[model samples]
Target chain A: MEKRVTFRGWMLPLLLILPQVVISAVFFFYPAGQAIWQSLFIQDPFGLSARFVGIDNFTFLLSDPFYRASFVTTAVFSVLVTLCSMVPALFLAVLADRLIKGSGVYRTLLIWPYAVAPAVAGVLWLFMFNTRVGIISWYLGTLGYDWNYVLNGGEAMGLVVVASSWGRISYNFLFFFAALQAVPRSVIEAAAIDGARFWRRFFTIVLPLLSPTTFFLLVVNVVYAFFETFGVIHTITAGGPQQSTTILVYKVYADGFVGQDLGSSSAQSVILLLVVGLLTVIQFKFIEKRVHY
Target chain B: MRKSLIGALLASATVLSPLAAYAETEVQFWHAFTGRLGELVKAQVEEFNNSQSDYVVVESHKGNYSETLNAGIAGFRAREQPHILMVFEVGTATMMSAKGATKPVYEVMAESGATFDPNAYIGSVKGYYTSTDGEMLSLPFNSSTPVLWVNRDAFEAAGVDPDTDLSTWQKVGETLTALKAGGEECPLVTAWQSWIHLENFSAYHDVPFASKHNGFAGLDTELMLNGEAQVKHLSAMGEWARDGKFIYTGRRNEGGANFRSGECALFTESSAGYAGIKAEAEFDFDVRPLPYWDGVGNAPQNTIIGGASLWVLEGHDAEEYKGVGEFLAYLSSSDVQAKWHQDTGYLPITAEAGEATRAAGFYDENPGTDIAVIQMTAKEPTANSKGLRLGSFDQIRGIIDEELEAIWAGDKSAQEAMDSAKERGDTLLRRFETANN
Candidate 1:
């Protein structure tokens, strides 16, 4: 009788959550479900008649080399960009903790690029990498490296990684800094008293305490690397110099918006959704429990 | 003298005039033109608004061609679409096939009883915008063909003759080598890779950009970009890229900055690049016909257009429709078209407007603005020379951009790149076919 009353007590809260759940269903689940439905059917620009073809779209995409290559490119790009951005961001956050003065100023300066719009960021980087009049290109040329992202695939990828990481550092740093701030001062002092040197304290105590934020940011950074960096690539490289940077999101945009192939583009989107969704679930399941807090 | 009566009449007339001016319906126009061209379009709208009382034209910049197209789509979905949309050449089929969604320009003109003659438009410019039965669908606003922009100052600095016959790609390649070898870094570059390289390449050689009347006749068109000649040209371009003779920029007018900055000696860019070039270039520059590949069959047949045209969207009230008609009529007027052509370096939509521009001697004074018109209308466009009409062409261009980039970066050979582009592009083609058929 006590257990039944406890279950009944919580019933109203779940009922109140119904509207929010329905709204999420409509906005999120419906579009995702519709995308999957559309992927299985062929569609014209007119949104006219569609014929359902069972698994044909998936089969066709799997056989296509371009789609396969884009998947690989996206994976490689996401991993590299995440690793580059997250590691440096943590380092900066830890360093910021050690600052005796002007830490607030340093924090403010680090978060500046986060305010720039994605398209504007792309245009800025595009101008900087421009071969003719770009300041970066001019300086590089003076040092004799040519610095043409258009001609060199490796350099194009490198530039993309740099531009993507530069903007991403702000986001990661914000989260890591907040986490670092919340770490108890007494625990850190205790570790120091125990003769845990600076590096040792950071690796064992501070890093373990920051694990929750790190894991959270890792998932977010992965998602960002997959989706957000496409804009930079779209603006900077456009998967060029021999398609060195044709990631999944870029391909989806190219296929859907530019090609106007709604069916195939939809198919590509759904495939991307599945891949990203699986990766996200795996990340949460494996990493979320490692957080002590 | 009836002074009291005269004073009362004058006071009443002043109030009436202001109301009459504000009574005109407002028509909204969304377009992709900006910079010098944006100013020119704004001027045209202001002039039209000033000259008219029935409708006031309000023009808004909706980003570049692709962004504008996307914005229109989103707006239409939200039922907030503008009356007129400036869609690029490749988006023609997408807009055309959107049934019950667009108001054909012919119907709009007829409804307004405006004097519109389809025959007045240049054949090459008008053909792409017309239907199978020859009905005008959209009003061609800014029509331009690809041409080679030679920075004569850069040429002089590099000690190469600016006017020496740059008629063939082989010659341009040699000249580019000479310039680069003489210490010029950005010797040659181009904008709109797919349009200039693949689309115009096919047209120049009197070959097809696609099959089945370039998809105008049907939806089952397959890409022919993987053909032998195209591969050969791409391979050569790849070689130039490796040798640092040709500077590869991002697709979609990335090299425009290079050409305008006078960093590159020769640039293959849309003729419409003229407005920006004229405005910004600190060096002497001239537009010439796009160079041909000597090995390709019948090189330099003609170049394809790379500008946008105004299309009327459906689902507006009668008053809005009238406003759209009046605004389109205002845009098509000889004076308006002529001024637009002169100001923006876009071709005049009508022959009379072209003649009006020439009579004013603008082309003669400008030196190379007329080259686009002359090259495009040099002869009647063969079926191959007529513009491509494939659905989802924008996406295909993206795929082409990807493959071409690969070829340029030396990761994929030209033949391999072309093959991948064709195969990838065809998957889209088949899907478009299955859907549209």
Candidate 2:
């Protein structure tokens, strides 16, 4: 049966949704439309003059090797960030779920990192891992291990991934903790009574029940790693050490703001928008099928 | 009726007050200075405001150089730009090509009927912000050039002569080898790697960094920095890096921290690095001319300026223009320019200001401070060594930085990195040409 709330006057329904429609149109549609429009033109840095060159920016970006390399960098970065953030968050959630007292204190302590801004978090990590004056770097040096991320591509990528994932673990932990608490005690007890071990019980009953949460988090974490790690990469590496860490979003900022190549930046943004859209569609289409609820 | 009568009386009294006699026109001046520089700029503004009764100049710090330029552009797009914008030297070409967006300083001075003389400015400094006919387009402010900053105590500790001659690259190399042999961890480090090591390297060697008179003659310039001279110099630096004689710090000025802490024996940085070094370093240091390769023809021609200048944005009212012109004239005055040079270690843009500083014995009191001025004004700038005026220069600099980093990391040879950088940078240049031309 289909149930609907009907408004007698058409004006009331229109008025009820006017704010959301206006917000979406103004903030989302308008700027996206502008990017699409601007991507078709090449303009001076100051916008004093603009020439219409339809499809040229997109074609140029597609043919550029650096832009293509950024795609691979983004992929590796997103996968690493998702795994690093979610695995520790799940372990912490499981540990907190087993606690009987002071769980609130543990949860509060774990949730504090999310309060720090991404750029600030990156700076904190950078200070600790700085090649010249960092305490950690000094310690590593004493251990006969030279740690200089400024020139090392692999180390630079690792530093950014660790910094980015460190900030995101708190958000993932909160959701995972909530989902774990909601798992029924009786189901676990019944499995225990049937002589199943703790690990077996968890794998059979609790883990299956948490599949829906896991799937949701996977999608959310992928998106978070994709769109929100720009500040981390910017403050830490700045897409250097031979462009090893120049992700898609960071490239947009470096090209648009730093380079002042607006057309290429807009084209890059359009491509990133399509990429996120496509990923979301794929996640909903295939990955959600295996989710329990 | 009583209340209305009271209101009318109050309005009349407000209009008749003595404080309302002169309505001072406000001139908005946005700059990119912070810390010590910021305080000095504020003092200058306060002096100007106190010296006048008809104009109030409101100065604001608008982030760092690139951020300030972006903010100015965004403000212009919103029709809320300040009357005066301080742009870094790299943004000269962008500002020049922004045709209707800015009113040239020469036009502003003439239209406001202010006493103006273009020849008062030092030629090499003014050449950066001028037209082909030698007309001043922007007022050069806070100009600086690259120089070698040597830690004398470090050199002495390393058993190298503190007064060793380092005018040529070969001499510097020998000094670095000696410093390394004497247990110095970092013999040499550089800031603005691409700027000091390549761009200025080309200019100082009197080689073309880019074609078309380094982009001054036309918009069709492409990078020519991968030539034999540049390759030889960069290869030497690369070899130094492999032997731990040269430290590879982060791209911009991060090496300053090491140098100031006395970890590095020599630093190639801006002449303006004096202020920071003086404030931070506990050891004796000296400023010297940037080293050149003896093999290159007539090496050490001149190193170009790297600081910023003041550009007058268009669409301002006539009265504001008058205030801007007056402020610029006041800023270019000999006393103010001399004090700025003495306090900040920037080159005095005006020849008169330089003379005044010399007369006051500022250079003699602060030994080695005059090296930058002498390096710039020693020879008339040639077409190859004047300065680069290419569009999309900031982006090209980034490409060059990446390539240089690759070379430093031993990922690529100097020739390979430079070739790649030139190819990548040329694409941006071509795009800039198409967009602007």
Which one is best on DockQ? 2
Task: List iRMS for all predictions.
Answer: 2.4, 1.0
Cα-based TM-score, every candidate: 0.90, 0.96
- What DockQ do the predictions score, one after another? 0.47, 0.76
- Once model 1 is optimally superposed onto the true structure by TM-score, how far is the C-alpha of residue B290 displaced, in angstroms? 2.0
Q: Model 1, which residues run further than 4 Å from truth?
A: A1-23, A46-49, A100-102, A181-195, A288-293, B1-23
Query: What docking class should model 2 receive?
Result: medium
- In order, the B-chain TM-scores come to 0.92, 0.94
Best by lDDT: 2
What are the candidates' C-alpha RMSDs?
6.8, 5.0
lDDT of 2 by residue, B105-125 (tens): 999999888787888999898
Q: Each model's fnat?
A: 0.70, 0.77
